[model samples]
Target: MLAVHFDKPGGPENLYLKEVPKPSPREGEVLLKVAASALNRADLLQRQGQYDAPPGASSILGLEASGYVAELGPGCQGHWKPGDSAMALLPGGGQAQYVTVPEGLLMPIPVGLTLTQAAAIPEAWLTAFQLLHFSGNVQAGDSVLIHAGSSGVGTAAIQLTRMAGAIPLVTAGSQHKLQMAEKLGAAAGFNYKEDDFSEATLKFTRGAGVNLILDCIGGSYWEKNVNCLALDGHWVLYGLMGGATISGPLLWKLLFKRGSLITTLLRPRDKKYKQMLVKAFTEQVLPHFSTEDPQRLLPVLDRVYPITEIQEAHVYMETNRNVGKIVLNLSQ
Candidate 1:
């Protein structure tokens, strides 16, 4: 099987196309003929050796893929067979022609979506859904502020927030991205490069602040989030794109104001929590992507590169030049 592999992670240049041995189904896993895989910020961190795959997990460089079932391992049952079209969010190993995932992790793809487009769903959509509903506790009529609104996660957040009857406020560096968010149901957009999102957020909420904030910019946007939240609002952080330290007694201030803060990672979640997330996502949201109804949920794909061009894909992401998701099309 031809797959992208890296010996020692550093830059995108480290990725190369090589014919590795094909994997066989394990006791509880099933093999998939991979059709496509999508990029994520976590992939960038992994390529830098800052992140490590789990114990016994694949050292591959992808998180989400769409594919068809090749064969099921023993003890697996209930409606799956060879050539069944599916998509999965695996522990790793998405950048390949074939990979195995636990049977329960796979979800049937909607009929209208190509394998290339279906590859974009799993990680971004799951992250957005978990933050807004599971952790942030967002509800209908609530106001939520999301950072990096042009990002893949941002694109998903805007759409999901609107679905729950919440108004989404977004921030990005460019007007083009802001317009993209607007088209996806963001009620308010801010330019963090030139505008003060804290002030703008206050104005948008009539000085009441927002009920929840989903942030990844960390130190660069942390203090601003503190200034922009409604009383008792939930503030969640999942990444630190900026510096990670604080110089003052910020915890005491937050305690005084009765605000809540949480930082979470998806990889460390218990199996049940992850399964719950995947199940809920499949039930409440995944059905919207059927061929009959035409409810497409993919973010704008700025570029799609073959598995051999992994190096170039990394360069594009590192340059911060893309507006939405950039994917690796393995199906072709």
Candidate 2:
């Protein structure tokens, strides 16, 4: 099997394709012939040596993949059979011709979606669903703000929030991205690079502020995010793209508003926890994709690159120019 490997943790230049032993399924697992894999910010961090794969997991760069089940190991017989189309959220090792995954992590490809589109769903959609419903506790008619609105998770969050009957507001760096967010069901969007998003959000919600906020930029947007929330609002932090330290006085405002600040990460969680999330998303969200209306829960893909152009893909992602997921077609 050919897999993406790095000589050292540094730059995309270090990534190379090499022949490696194909992985075999263990108990409760299945071996998949990977058709496509998607890119994420975590992949960039891992390549730069800022993040490490969880203990006992593969060191490969990918976090999610879509493919066909080639074999099922012991204890996994009834769950899925060989030749079944599936997608999975993996801890790592998705950037290869094949990967072994826990059967519980595999999701049947939604009806009418191609393998490449399925490949783009797991990580972004699952993360968005978990953050909005579980952590943020978003309810119908609630006002929610999503930062980085044109990103993979952002695009998913916009659609999910709207579907849940919440008012979805967003922030992006460009007018084009803002438009894209609105088209995906965001009530409104702000150009974060050129506008005071906090003020804009307040105006959009008529000064009541939003009930929840999904944030990826950390310190730089911390104070603003706190100010943009309604009383008893929830602010969920999933990334620290703009540094991690907060330097201003924010405790008083939070106390006055009875706000809650929560931080979370998905990659390092135990298998049991991930299985719980997968089950919840599979039951609640997957059905939307399988319905007769195939467009209902489609993933937004920015671009698809062949496996051989892995370096170029990384370069494109690092530029922060994409409005949605960037996929790698393994079979290409």
Candidate 3:
């Protein structure tokens, strides 16, 4: 097996494809032959030593992958065998050609999707789904705001928000990104650089504010998110791309608005919690895939770089030059 490993944490330059021992499945686990893996901001943090794998997780740095089952461990059940196409959200180790995963975390590839595209869904879509449905407690006709509307998570957020019958308001850096979000079901888009999102969100809601907010960029958005929430609304914080800090006065003001601040980290979340999320995604959302083909099941990637070109992929993501997921194709 080959994997992207780093001896010293730094930038993309630190990533190198190296031969490593193939991981074998343990009890209740399964081994996968990785076809594709996608990059995330967390991968960047891991590369720079800012993030560490969860306790007992692999030191290898990939969070999601699409692959085929190569081996199954003892105590696993259900209808599965060698060559079953599947996608999974892993805490790490997805960068390798062969990695072991807990059977509970893997899901059969949704109908109408290729293994590569399926790789793009597990982490981003799961995160978006959890944020909008589980944390936000969205209801039909409710209003929601999502930041980073062109990100992988952002793209998934737009689609899930629409599916739940909620109006999705998005903030992206460019009009092209905003347009992309609109095509994906976002009802409104804002240029975060040019507009004050908090003011815009309130105005868009006719001064009532939104019922929920899915915030990936923290820092200033934290304060503005508080200002943009309707009374008793929930704000789900999933990432801090900008910064991570919460002010006392902000908490006081949120108390006034009856806003509840909820934060979650997928990797560190309890296994039972993640299992619940995986179950929810499988039962409630996976069944909705269009019967026609996979394009509707998952968005197309803007770029696919070989595992050897991981550096370039990281650079592209840092520049935010790509829309949708940027995946590493092991076949290349």
Cα lDDT computed for each candidate against the true fold: 0.85, 0.93, 0.86
Summing lDDT over every window of 10 consecutive residues in candidate 2, give the lowest-scoring window: 289-298
Give the runs in model 1 whose Cα sits over 4 Å from its true position. Answer: 291-296
Backbone atom clashes (below 3 Å) for every candidate = 1, 0, 1
lDDT of 3: 0.86
Put down candidate 3 lDDT per residue, 138-243, tens digits, no spaces.
9999999998988999898888888888899999999899898898888899998999988988898999999988888887687788888999998898988888
lDDT of 2 at 326: 99
For candidate 1, what is the lDDT? Answer: 0.85
Q: How would you encode candidate 2's per-residue C-alpha lDDT over 138-176 as one tens digit per residue? A: 999999999999999999999999889999999999999
Clash pairs, candidate 1, are 35-331
**TM-score quality measure for candidate 3:** 0.96
- The lowest-lDDT stretch of 10 consecutive residues in candidate 1 is 291-300
